[model samples]
Target: MSRYEEAKLNYEKMGVDVEGALTLCAATPISIHCWQGDDVRGFDQKDGRAGDGIQTTGDYPGRAGSFEELKADFLKAASLIPGKKRINLHASYAVFPEGEWADRDKTAYRYFIPWVEFAREHGFGIDFNPTCFSHPMVKNGLTLSSPDEAVRRFWIDHCIACRQVAQRMGEALGDKVLNNIWVPDGMKDVPADRMGPRLRLKAALDEIFAENCPNVIDSVESKVFGIGLESYTVGSGEFFMAYASQHPGVYHLLDNGHYHPTELVSDKIPTLLCYFDVLPLHVTRPVRWDSDHVVLFDDELREMMTEIVRCGGLQKVLIGLDFFDASINRVAAWVVGTRNAQKALLWALLQPHEALKALQDSADFTEKMVRMEEAKTLPFGDIWREYCRREGVSADESWFEDVKAYEREVLSRRGT
Candidate 1:
């Protein structure tokens, strides 16, 4: 018998439906971040620099130099990946006509109409984030919770404008646009008055989320800390979780890299599933600190996906990728990270969850351990290859050749 046929038979014997896993995984959409190609250097800035708390390491050559270049690179990377996909865009990536410009607060939907056109043509959903960092107005490392009313108002207006832009994008694309808000408002050292900033932040969020937009899914993201902002983060997990819990139609987003080093998002998924009807995730790899590393088919990723599938919230949760690594080939990074995420999900889906649950519930720990150990050695590679073949993407490392060719033919020509 053929290898795939043998693998399929083996999986069936274990009560795992191989075909079902492939079908479900193919329909799962992962939101790919746009900032990866340019190392978080958005098109809005001519200086090509991020904010105080924001930093992109390494000087990788052939970074996308323009909106057109970024789109082209994204398309190439997307082509190599399998299953359903969506584009996650930051407001800083907004494009404008020649000789025209708009600051963060003054940004209009017109600047992002090209993104909508792109999404429509490509048959991809779009998600958005308000660019809260990399701006001059974020004085003293505070925004949305700034003591300066002018600074706070600027960011508030910016977020409000971003929501409108997202609303228009969703209307244009015929899908709800997840508009996530993550502000870099924190202090370099311990702060004397945390309550004042948090109170102000709560008020700012109240104002930003005051109006309801039909096409936008609002999400608030919290960070434990950032590069320069180490001691205190104004938007802590407790604050946003409480706020999102109280507010209707707003969701609290969890970034895998946005928490303390020891905490795992895999464990938190089940907790959030209990309270939230719908959850949004920012899947990323955190090395030591919250360093945005390229994701791999690692243990944490597998555990995270396993939890999502086990909870039967596969469709209820929104999955979006968030990371930028300039140390390697940008297109290759995109393909590897996204494909690894899909692989993790597919692996989780292929598990015999019902049998495992039964074993655990009946206190058959020995049998459960044996079954789990055997599952690790199953013909998952064959199933994964079959999946890639069915999806019409390269089933192996051959796809890297295409990325290399593109680098030589297109990326290498960009001036030094």
Candidate 2:
């Protein structure tokens, strides 16, 4: 038997449905940020809030619809793509201050409460991502790294408010809300001045989870690079892991595109999974060092997916399409991104472990890498065409037409 067949048999012996496995692996929610307005401007100004102006005048591209519009668009998009539930709220932009530090904090809570209530009424889970840039306190950054006490206090208050709202939302949704936190408090020029703020944030997180809700997972997401003076603080996965270890309720959130292109996630992923025991994953395609790419799969992605399956780590994964393409239609972008994700999952499921083993066990890792790269590049549409041909079934454009037709039907039913 081929390696795929062997793995299939092994999987079958475990009483796992290979086909069902693909669907389940593909199951992930479409998370949307609320502040993305109608225009394709990168700055979110839906709430009519202040300090929302952009410093640079470059034309920013991506979906820039309001909260309700984005939600409706996502519903239409999700209906077309099967097996996805829940949408992430853009809590970051929602909390941006209009002016004055005190007023902004109060205004933030006012804006946040309604979103929590909306998520509850809609039967969707809310994933809260804290935005530290809204307040002038963090024009540089926030958390323990802030040079000013006023800025640090402002961040703490905002975090506290976020946790409170998250707790209430979780309670309303039967603890379905995911309280996610990704700090932009790292330094670029300086080596380290934010250690104190980081420590404070950790303590605050511990208190939040200890108080109201144990159901919500506090996912600490990390980026690969920092932008300014406070840029280098938490720029890598290792920093996140270390920081998370200091707190009781915190867990690491891994974004695929945040690492170096050549980094072997197969080994790295298992270590993180085992370390945390229970963790949430963020999925996306990163080009060079820049993330938010809405493109299809690449070679490194195949290695990441294969290892996740080999380690039996699908259940812990929370798939996210972190792409932002303003040029494309908002609704269509979601559709295409979700479809790409679905295709990636299918490809991962069909991957043969024995093929990987043969390549790895070979003398030179270079040949193995080349073969793995080829496997990753396999197109789902082409695979479907080949399957039809092999089965002696006539192939036509009608198949694709039917798929699009079904999508439109779902969207119509949703009144999108």
Candidate 3:
């Protein structure tokens, strides 16, 4: 018998539908972030440097410098990845007409029409984020919660405008656009009056979320701390969780990288599934700190996906990639991280969740442990190869060789 046939029989013995896992894996939509290609340097800036806490290292030779180059590079990256992929955009990536520009507050649907058209062409969904960092409007490392009314007002207006743009993008594509808001509003030193800033932020959120856009899914993201703003994070996880619990429509987003080092987002996923009808996730690998590093098919990632599947969050969770590492080939970075995420998800889907749960519920711990360990010996690599073959992408390291050829042919000549 063929290897895949043998693997399928083994999984079927465990009550796992191998074909169903492959179908769901391919049909699942994962949002791919755009900032990775150019190292988070959006086209909106003159120097194209994302100076705010969104930092990236390495002097990669072929960083995309313009909107056209970025689009081309993104297309190249997308081609290397399989399954239903979507583009996640920060408002800072808004494209204006040649010789004309609009500040964040004044950004309109016109500024993002190209992106909408691009989505239509690729048959991909689009998600949005109000880029709250890398701007001059920030006052003393704060935006929505800034003490300066002008600074707060500017950011609030910008977020409102982004929602409008997000609504329009969703309308254009006939799919809801995820409008997630992540503000780098914190302090380098502990603020004396914490209540004041969070209160102001709550009020600002009230204002930004006042006029509901039917097609926009609003989300709020909290960070433990950033590079310069380490002492205190204004929008703490507790604050956003409480706010989300209070507000019916606003969802609290959880970035795997945006938490304390010891905390496991895998554990939190099931905890959140118990309450929230819908969950949004930002998948990134954090080494020690919340540093946005390329994702791999590692233990934590597998555990995270396992929780999502076990908790029946496949339909409810919105998955999006948020890592950027200019230290390697940027397009290759996209391929590796995104494929790893899909691989992890597929791995989770291949497990026999029902049988395992039954074993746990009946106090059959010994059998559950034996079954779990035995699964490790199954023909999983064959199944994974079969998945890649069906998806029309290379299953082996041959994919990287394709990336290398593209780099030598296209990326190497850029900015020359």
Candidate 4:
């Protein structure tokens, strides 16, 4: 038998439904980072210029040139993925020097306009990260945790401006633009004297939500670290549940990599779903040291998928492959990482509900493990190939190649 056939046999041994797997696969929205390459700038440790001594407040990478060029580059990178056009704008563009946070009005408007136009012209949506680490306001972190009143004001104003811009852009494009807000506003030290800033930040968010910007959905991102501040108020899951619940339009956005090392991945999704409400997901693998590494699939990932299926909220889950500058080509990095994520989702869907029901109803941990072990494993690429072969969809060697070809065709017609 052929290698494809052999792989199929292995998948079948897992006892998963092939058709159900593909259906979940196709429903899954393949997303990537908007700032697709070395263009991402912020947090001097990662991609910023060396020896600046300044930790934050670096220049924006994508804004090095004209706005038109940046817009075109974004389109070029996005065109590579088939049936997957949604993107998450890097926080750097909205906060770095020459970015939206730098200007109160014009620059912010100019910065988001191109993306809005791009979305309108291409029929795609854009996700925004409310400035996390660039501006002086965030030097110590933002929202419910900033010590300085002036710095807290700065952060709050930036968020207000983003809501306004998102509203305008939505009117311009006729679609919702997601406002993703994650704060490095947690404390590593003692938790005293943190309540004042926390209350202030909460009040600020309440004011922003009262504005009722129809174009924006505030998705609050949670993290475990406090940057310059001695401590943070909103780091853990319980904190997010309490804080986000008070707000009208905001929802908790769970980053897969942000959980504690000892935390159970399966328990997280269902627990969050049961309590704080399910929002969009920021998908990425976390290392033992809590570094955000974009790597391949592992056996542990199955737990996350199992929980996702168990919750029966697949539609609420939005896929984001949150990778940093570890790869040579950003597009290739996203496609490969996303492919693995999709495979995991597909495998989870193939699992019979009966198996999950058993686990959910069981009191014994060993019984649950046995049920989990009985679920089948599906080779993602092989399944894709099989589906394509059955449906007569031609297989491309690489997603990047497909992207380049499309770019050439589009630019050629534009006479670039």
TM-score of each candidate structure, all chains considered together? 0.99, 0.70, 0.98, 0.75
lDDT for each residue of candidate 2 in 1-416, tens digit (9 for 90 to 100): 65444555555543345555545544545454333222222233334332211111122333333455555555555545544456665444453335623342342445665566666666567776655554445545455345576766666666666666666667666765666766566655756454565566566555435655555667777766644532465435776788677666677777765666766555677887776655666666666754455546565565666666666777665555455554444455555565556555655665655556666777668967776565444444454343334333333334345435644554334422
| Model 1, span 147-237: residue lDDT tens | 9999999999999999999998888888899999999999999899999999999999999999889999999998899888899999999
Q: Could you tally the backbone clashes for each prediction? A: 0, 20, 0, 6
Q: Judged by TM-score relative to the true structure, which candidate is superior, 3 or 4?
A: 3
Roughly what TM-score does model 4 have, to 2 decimal places? 0.75
TM-score of 3: 0.98
lDDT, candidate 1, at 294: 93
lDDT of 2: 0.54
Deviation in Å, model 4, residue 222 alpha carbon: 1.6
lDDT, candidate 3, 1-416, per-residue tens? 99999999999998999999999999999999999989888877776676666788888788887788889889988887878999999898888887899889887999888888998998989999998888888778889998899999999999999999999998899999999999888888878998999999999999999997999998999889998989988899999999998998899899999999999899999998888998999999999888889999998999999999889888889999999888889989999999999999999999988999999999999999999998867788899999998988988888889889888998899982
lDDT of 4 by residue, 1-416 (tens): 86567766765565656666666666566556654343344332223431111122223222323345445555555543334456677444543334224433222655666566666677776776655454434543454356677666666776777777777766777767777766667555676675665576567677656788888877777665433443444545666667777765688887766666777656667766775444677776777633456546676566677678758767665656666533344444555565566556666766666654666677666866775665443455676666545533333555567645644554334421
Q: What shift in Å separates residue 99 of candidate 1 from its native position after superposition?
A: 1.0
Model 1 residue 19 CA deviation (Å) reads: 0.6
Better of 1 and 2 by TM-score: 1
User: In candidate 2, which residue ranges exceed 4 Å CA deviation?
Assistant: 1-18, 26-65, 93-104, 107-123, 192-212, 229-231, 234-236, 264-266, 353-416
Relative to the true structure, how large is the alpha-carbon lDDT of every model?
0.92, 0.54, 0.90, 0.58
Candidate 1 pairs with clashing backbones: none
